[model samples]
Target: MKIFRILQIMSLIGVLIPMGCSDFLEKKSQDEVIVTTVSDFDEFLLGSGYVTYVQYANLYFLDDDIEYYESEYYDELSDVMASYGFQSWQPDMWESEEVIRTNWETYTSTYSRIMGVNAVLDGIDKARGEIEARDQVKAEALALRGYYYFMLVNTFGEPYNYNKKALGVPLKLSADIEENGMPRNTVEEVYMQIVEDLRESSALFEKYPKRRGNYRINLPTVNILLSRVYLHMERWDSVIVAANKAIQYSEGLTDYTKFSGSNFFMCSYDHSEVEWIYGVGVNIQFFGPSADLLSRYDKNDCRPGMWFDMGEYSTNRLLKKDYDWMSGSATPVNTVRISEAYLNRAEAYVQKGMTGEALADLNEVRCNRITGYTNIENVPANLLEEVRLERRLELCFDEQRWFDLRRYGMPSITHRYRYRKSDPWVIYTLREKDPLYTLPLPNEAIRNNVRLEQNASAYEPKRSGVEE
Candidate 1:
């Protein structure tokens, strides 16, 4: 990518640059004025990564709603996601101008934000902080860079283990130096890069004592993410180890069962769990199940509803700013919870042929909720079906539904079930393919990278069915 163009875009976004911060705001301090060194630059740059990381959640809607709901194809696909498990963008189901624009903007912005992060990592070393802080900062920055990459990789890149050699976007770790039209890297290569970054991050943070907030990625959060990555990799042994480490290092959830009152949703600290390594939450939630999906359940279900998944440590007043405006977890402090640890353990058991063990892990989660479930145990006869239900209900909008469905062999963006037009009242079963699997790399990115092969399915015409 051209440095000039990239810089221009970054400036427009008010990213990585302090020039846009003032109406000539007072005067600069002595230290601030002279410190144009890389360390200062690094500090400036590092903030951009956090910005990108925050936007990752915005992409949740595309996968769950749009593709999962279609004509007859809708009913079939509900087996994967959505409340009605349909009503999103199924080929041509949802055509509102507002929803369409929001959908478009949310998904695309994730890529744009990453460009800002790359800028900081590429040029922030002239004046590294004191020896200790300098190293710590780099570790956090590097790991976060990988964290953003992993999000993009999973969302747009095909499953790495399922198809090791599948093509994914080129690694753009450095904003200043990526080539225009960079070619796709093998999915394995993309994963290798992510693994390396996470491993480096884990080692550095383990040694650093002061890693409680956004400043440094903490031990528990790292293990949490590591467990997730391993599960995605289908590395059951690694998944088990990471899950155990997370549990041992941190406290578990806030015991939702014991929390008082009907308004339990607002408690940020419920179900005592470990502190998140890099937590960023806001009460100003921008997305929820569109009206069509919510029409299926009671108006108050806080669960992801086939859409998706929250945060804490509030110095920014963020936790309170939009607290009264949204649904799902109350307080802006959303979390990556203890439930994830159980989910991972259950998945690991599945791979080990210990179905009983998997069921136990799952039961542990189901039995704990104040909102109780049936004593259902002994594992489902259809193994994939069991995983799908557990993962869908557990992970919800946590951004795991699409991947879980994909990994389990029914990979498609379009809903699998079909719907009948005459019977808005009737739910007929049908399956169709209008897959929204991996994201289509932005037109701008693809145009810039000559070597990059566009996702072959990127331009599939919208039709009346969901993809398989």
Candidate 2:
């Protein structure tokens, strides 16, 4: 009860900056704490700061999904947009303080969630509650913690296949805050922790009541996260197993043909296709779908109309209708959907040489998105490529494309930007396996914790034709 109350106060003050000094961690509020009962613990889990959505604005700039055009308001560009634009235009932009701070904020916010999770796990056992209620609370905390760590490692560390020995974000396991510096764990160690936590969470979910919405983690969500983890680890058979388990519970997909105009702005909160929802709102005024990305969509594919708006001059901007109009937040941006499970299974089947099974799964999702949908009879020579294309089409602008590119062998990315209507387009390229692909740790983080080493390939300033 005391720990939960402490966590409640800490959550309010945003004091859970991980590995901070003991004095900061020990500070407590005098306000009457409410986390004395099982229900109170549940409320703590649902607290605003603890269960917040992730913002994708920073990651969006790094991917090839968006394009930049000079606005009439400025022959030049605004500072905010200019900062992000340079990141897209110049490979060395990661060295900039602005870019480093943006990335650092995401890292700090994710670990803050982990801190809250550890608080619940540490106190749940002592609460006077029904056995089932305690287990359910603990399960949710484990899942949430694992989910945060998964995001951190993927963003800050090298892809699993690239090097298991590569450094990952610090792995924090306890509620008792440590003032001392913590070393980065290897990618393999971090991944193993994620798997262990999720696997335990799955077992605990059997004791918890079935949750109604995609907003909260449940049995199906656990399996879905597991499927994703397996996919990243390249455990083909496990991917199929986990995906199948998730599909058994939630298999609904929105029928695009039956739907009417502009469903693109619909968040997962209202969208039937979503299986789990967790993404923050983003402003895409200057960033729109790339010409190349728009080209990938078939004319008949309903997704283009539903997901993007081709305004005057055929400029493609993501539809904001699905987002919270009043608050400008988008629901389910960082979610796992039923379609993703099928995609996961399909990809796994392909890796396992079960081309027929893979194609069947692929067709399941394609039929729902394309008009006059028909199943493919013969597998294409590039079966994996075809599946990957569907993933890009299905999951674009949702913060998956950037990570997908990295995991898929760090493919070359080229972005074409035009400063003015009269200016010829200038192309910027990120070569395959470029050091910039793995962003450097924030300068402040390295300074605060001596144990935290800077990435080998820290950003170096390079002049590009685009004005900063």
Candidate 3:
């Protein structure tokens, strides 16, 4: 079948099903035939229906890493200035339909991809094909599903550390769609499902063909993801084990010293160091690094110069060259690379009181990014704090900082913005453990499915009469 026809079928699959079940499986359209052949399922998995990049634009807005110039020119652009609510730590940034739509898209798009994966899992066993081809398709789908769920839970559900018993996104296992409403699963249950899928994916990958592309998920990628999931679950020992396994199979970090100051490289997925790359493309025109974040980079650290540029107004805009801007290309706003594995291991080591091991791993990453770097012979008493700082500096704008802030005891974040050079600055503060830390579900989603429950914190009425 043609790709459009397949997508149409997928759309119908998404819409026809009722809200009762948390699984991605929806009732099939009467007009469409059930896809049973491995070839058709393989084509569908690789087709446009499968969302390759996950978009977390809302999460990016919530981080302390960005700054918007307060100016008459920017203020005239309502849509552009609207983002200020996110940066200013407003409680209900989802007031506008556009903002709500963007947030809602993230939820639906991710689940759509999950639905595609479920279709493959449901049909692969019945399809007649070469055993290797079938196994490869199944393994890839399983890994992709696991990854999507990980993203969903992290974004929509409460932080695992906050309350495992807290409500999580609905858990959908099978592809069979039904008309029953499903209650939210506990955070623990959702995590257990993610772990199960990823573990199965890891075992399946060993039997499948070697996956070479950074875009594709294989054993190493699966392990790296597992490391992240375990880190969130506070399974420190398991995190160390998973990170070490992933590092053993993946590429080492790129040495910044090799590139001249003027020729500093951008962090792109094509870079040899990236283990897995998946995220929506970011438009650098509207975004820039906060002065405070930029100040953290050491004079010798090459990343500051490489990832940012001073614009005409002297503002430090994120470098556009870091992403693929060509239409249809997957511009990764977030990624999983080999360096993260090292950092994951280092954090886990610090939690286990293995300061020396932690420092070794931390220095390993610093050695590559900082010029003329030297390793310390002893670990500091504040080794965990040191590791956290390194992680923030290293992964500044890649959507990790905000999540880190939440998981790290929800530290208070204060942002300062000025409308113009001569204007007094407006200050906004995000308190630790504030309810706004958790985003509310989109209004449309709740309306469409009455059974859906809103986050307690997200229930605040939208603010009105706020200055643009």
Candidate 4:
């Protein structure tokens, strides 16, 4: 990598202040920010190592759960114009005329945070602190790095189960800035790293076992992440084991029946069900539920009424804003909750031919979220489908839908968009097993590293016209 690229990584974590290209080359590599205290590492991680929900906003648009409603001035609005490629599933999503698009923000943001985490992991061992405190810092960094890789691999690479041999994101395990860009790892290799980091995290947690707030990583959070990863890998027994541990350690589920107001139901970070509160608040005002997703909710389910604005065309709006939307601050959303552990176990049970156990898990979530809920005594014939439906309903808009869609065989999906009120709808279809399922490496990445190969184009050349 060039000095500029190395500077990008260093500057992202506030470690470098290179004045000019020529001047930076003369300075010693060790002349950078010096953070040598346990307190310094903790603050550094919190400030630069964390990712906001905005980093995942693009994925939310790609999932089938969202329905894009275009206005008459669609082409005039900058946001709508910029999002057109992603909303329509175009391969040139990050290289469009509407925006100066050269890179995927999600890709850059995630890798940047991973670099920050790497910084902490690189030097925290020698930091001045108690052994247990250093262990806590190390555990959090390991878990966070694993989680970041999980996001990157899922977004920029093919699904692990679909093709573990497929190309994945580069594994940057060290804080040392590279003079040459690294090659992409195999999907299997990336997943191996993720599992290793999480295992280390789990071991460190066992040593310290400290409870930060739900906003931070804990033992339960690590287990939940493991269960999710194993679920994607189709390791059913591993999912059951990890999810069971998460459930045992979690604070327990929040009963929807207890709250009549949907506004504050899941708005607080301190909610009982939350495992780790992370991610920036998404502007739900820009999107709404897809008809397919909306139909999955039962009439007796309390979520729809509480979670959505049920007025005319309210299906185009998500009513559940973040806890601090009333204020002018970003609300950190929870990526893992107690309900997910139940759902994970349920799906694992169904795969393992334990229909009764799966149904019990479904009932556990349904009973808490559904009003006038009736416990089904008998296992349904389509037990796996039932578990999947429940999982979708419970984890919708929480950044799981897109990945779920990918692991579920990358099903065909269609999005309809119109440029104006008078114009007919333009149909955009992502056919089953389409290469579009795996996003291409960001152009900036490929430019920086000739060793990196971009994924296949997502565009379907034959299917871009307006439907009459």
lDDT of each: 0.52, 0.70, 0.68, 0.75
How well is each residue in 1-468 modelled by candidate 3, as lDDT tens digits?
Answer: 211223343564353423243222222554444455567667667653344443566666677887774322444344345565666655556566655444434666666677768767777777768887788778778878887787777666788999888887878665555355456788789999989888888777777545756355667778888888899999999998888778777767778777765655353655657666555545544467777888887889887776666546633265523523435555544456787888888999999988889999999999998999999788888889888888888877665777787788887777665444455666777778877777676555566456778887676554333232
Which portions of model 3 show Cα errors greater than 4 Å? 1-9, 12-30, 33-39, 48-54, 70-73, 100-104, 261-270, 313-316, 320-334, 417-425, 461-468
What are the per-residue Cα lDDT tens digits for candidate 4 across 1-468? 112133456674334333443221333254444565778677677766776546766676787888765422434555556667777777777666653442236676677788878878888888888888888889999999999999999998999999999999999998776666788999999999999999899888877544847367888889889999999999999999989888887778888877775455465655788767776656544467778888988887788776665556432355443434546666575456878999999999999999889889999899998888999999989888888988888888877888999999999988876655576877787889788788766676677677777787644353374584
**CA lDDT of 188 in candidate 2?**
93
Error of 2 at 431 (Å): 1.3
Instruction: Name the weakest run of 10 consecutive residues (lDDT summed) in model 1.
Output: 313-322
lDDT of 1: 0.52
Identify the leading candidate in terms of lDDT.
4
lDDT of 3: 0.68
By TM-score rank, best first, the candidates go 4, 2, 3, 1
> lDDT at 64 for candidate 4?
86
Listed in order, each prediction's TM-score against the native is 0.69, 0.86, 0.85, 0.89
What's each prediction's clash count? 46, 3, 5, 5
Predicted structure 2: lDDT = 0.70
Model 1 residue 155 lDDT?
62
Better of 2 and 3 by lDDT: 2
Candidate with best TM-score: 4
- TM-score between candidate 4 and the true structure: 0.89
Candidate achieving higher TM-score, 2 or 4:
4
| Candidate numbers sorted by lDDT from highest down | 4, 2, 3, 1
